[model samples]
Target: MNSLKLPDIAAQKLLHVTPLDWVGMCAIALPIQLEGRHVAAMADAGVNLVDGKSRGIHMSRLYLALEQLEHQALTPLAIHQLLADFLASHEGLSTAAHLRLSFEHLLKRPALVSPLAGWKSYQVSVDARLENEMFHVELSVRVPYSSTCPCSAALARQLIQRQFEADFSGEVLNRESVLAWLGSSQGIVATPHSQRSQASVQLRLRNNLDTVPVTELIDAVEASLGTAVQTAVKRADEQAFALANGQNLMFCEDAARRIHQALRELDIATAFTLRVEHAESLHAHDAVASSQWQW
Candidate 1:
């Protein structure tokens, strides 16, 4: 039996009509390579057409085009080019295109000794848009750290001191005796709660460039706060972590201020957003603060 031939849709378009304002898919998960590192990323691609009288769009074509981008480098420059190509493929249907990709960026870091280390993951997002022959890209990251409650620490110190005095009444207090008393339950009436904290920074790039170093950003954040959460730790590392936390006791406001100051020192533009959230262990609610560059 002979198969009947069908007419091509691209060639049979006889009706002239306005295109759609926005068309495409979202949350497209795929593997991507960045800086020679393979990572799983999700991409949201869409186009805005001059909508007037079109029944629908060729969604499969968009997905096929994105499939080509898979396994390829996803730098800022490459993303700009990809969006341009996507818009070109749509031809008269759209004059603008937008794409958003998000992924978990993993970095291997050493703990505070014990010869053991592991990877720490962060949430990264990249957004790009093309309009009027121009492209814009924005990069964002969420970094986690540790924040100690300064208020709680001060109160705990007072309570412990008071309890120590009461427990050692009528006994000659010496440095060793005081130390022993403090180590017992009678000395530490209360201990402050320092919770795990996270901060998000979103920066709008001036040009299509991948100059922003992810490692540098992570280092700056960890250094500015003087303490970071550990992925792998031993008994020695735990003790070292406690010491570090004691030295870097900070409030939520202090955490935000530290990040804000660090970002200002960077070469990035004065316009950016910094948000910090501290999940309080003492209370059911979290402490959050935000600071944005005015320029």
Candidate 2:
């Protein structure tokens, strides 16, 4: 076997002498430790090519640096160090480093009124950047909830009231008779329309935070909506969920406002943007609303 020097084309000079904004790889499959759980994740790693005279950046260096994420828990400090390593590897060729990690975070959710519980998956992403000695992290999550149309609920109540008046117009109203009638399907003529909805929240985290508040943020959003979808439900839990939907009727706009207000009160993020999407069962199209604060 003969040892030959490999060609260093990336180090060669470029005739165009043009600098690139971002140069690296995307959708790199990897495993990361987050919140004490080992998560299967995909990463997008890149850096801004500041040196115009160079032909291209060393892509292999960025890929190698991402290995650090596998060993340590994902945090602001861990991401900060990763970006530092990216710039260090590229040295003069690059100045700014950017990394985006996408994964499904599994969380155990309990039934509304039952002891049963099951695992739910939430789509989560973390975007990090370090430029000009400044660092910022953005956390994004997608949550699914149930949204009942308020207008539909009001109309259904109106129809039910009219039916009740017609049924007991000339009869003496008694507790047992009314209870039996109310339990009958014919008594409740109409029901409100509800659809599965999703809330997507993007938060720009405070620089001083030590850890990412993913679970806390999710709890706040779910609490505000009050109709989060359930798993492994019993009869009692289903009935409770139905009652919750009836009590917490909302439109897309209402859902967005609720999430916005909840995020505003939280201290985790300096800025945030939220979007609520209702997959309308009444129509073929989906209803959507978006809101933002300091962003």
Model 1, 165-225: lDDT tens per residue? 6787788768998777767886788988889999998876656455535666777788899
Candidate with best TM-score: 2
Worst 10 residues of 1 by lDDT: 7-16
Q: What is the lDDT of residue 112 in candidate 1?
A: 94
The lDDT per prediction is 0.80, 0.94
Estimate the TM-score of every prediction.
Answer: 0.86, 0.97
Residue 124 lDDT in candidate 1: 90
Error of 1 at 254 (Å): 1.5
lDDT for 171 (candidate 2):
97
